[model samples]
Target: MACSACGSDSAIVCSLSDEYRDYAPADAAVISICTHCLTVDPADATSVDTGREVEPDFSRLSDSVPTRPERAIPLVLAIDLCSSIATNRSAIESLLEEVERAGTDPLLVIDRLRADPDVEPAVDLERRRHQLEQLLY
Candidate 1:
């Protein structure tokens, strides 16, 4: 459905099961937000075709299982670790300096922050570091 505010067809529609505290309606109410203007508006629940919704295929779940299970890292922790590498020298360093810092291994923190330099802000830093290294060479 097109957004009423911006008239943009590129809008995100979400189905809410309950009221969103003076924002969304309750009882499976549909809301649309314009990606352009970022306006949130109530949309007609009937406007969405519920029949087109994809059902989860449980047949794959019964299929072959991997011998080794993959470990999933929490998003918040990943973001925090990335942030520590990105802006910690300017932000967290000052905050950490006040206390009698002890028992904290600097190498451990360095290892984690540098572990996945290909991820996000770390990638940016890694690219810059590579450029600087090239210049030095």
Candidate 2:
């Protein structure tokens, strides 16, 4: 995947893993970041081993995005299991299309999507939309 920060095509995923020796919380989980951008992502973290047994490292990769994306690179990926909008590809496509057309607030587009009468609001629409909004920003 391309780097989120520098937009470099050679970007990789790395872990800023916590060392238990530091007395970190028991609930601590691996954090995955774009090695090029150092942006933390939970979604990517779960897709791989993370290999962050004791400390953070970036020398390996469990997977990679096919290549550089043509548009709408996800800058702020939600590491949590809360991104409903990601599954709603049609909604995402419409939203991105509108954003391209208006070149204005994508949040407004999301609000409109949430308010659309034909669309049955997902139980977690607001929260998922918030996650999607973070991606746009």
Candidate 3:
């Protein structure tokens, strides 16, 4: 794959672990950016270990042991915008509208968006607007 920043042919795929307890997952994929020019090299991306602990199983415990089941919580989608002219507002609004129409909770929507190459300093307002339009309406 070509670098998103410098258009370099070299790139690596990388994996990452979720950091937050709420949104954390077992693992995730990330593209490595060039250290020299800060260019995102998708082809050269590599996975990085986050060292997160794995969930333990307690089904086979002794009869005297006390065990609690994991709680199931509503899903909350996370939206992020890149430098392109786009945002997540429209997507969220459209999602809310769909939920209302379907008479379902917004938690049913499990979609999330993030910057492809990891935008720096955040995307501009115009870009956010465009992103919202593209994602939602």
Clashes of each: 0, 2, 20
**What is candidate 2's lDDT per residue for 1-137, written digit by digit as tens?**
44433454433333332421121112234334444333433334464554544332323221121122111122112212234455644445444444445443545534654565543322345666666565555
lDDT of 3 by residue, 24-83 (tens): 122233434332222322222224344753332222211111122121111111222133
Give the range where candidate 1 is weakest over 10 consecutive residues by summed lDDT: 65-74
lDDT of each: 0.34, 0.37, 0.30
RMSD per model, one decimal? 15.0, 14.6, 14.5
- The reply for model 1, stretches above 4 Å from the true place, is 25-28, 51-137
lDDT of 1 by residue, 56-122 (tens): 2212211211111110111111222233344433322322221114333232332343443322222
Off by more than 4 A, model 3:
9-14, 19-28, 36-81, 85-137
Which candidate gets the maximum lDDT versus the true structure?
Answer: 2
| Candidate ordering by lDDT (highest first) | 2, 1, 3
Per-candidate TM equals: 0.31, 0.25, 0.24
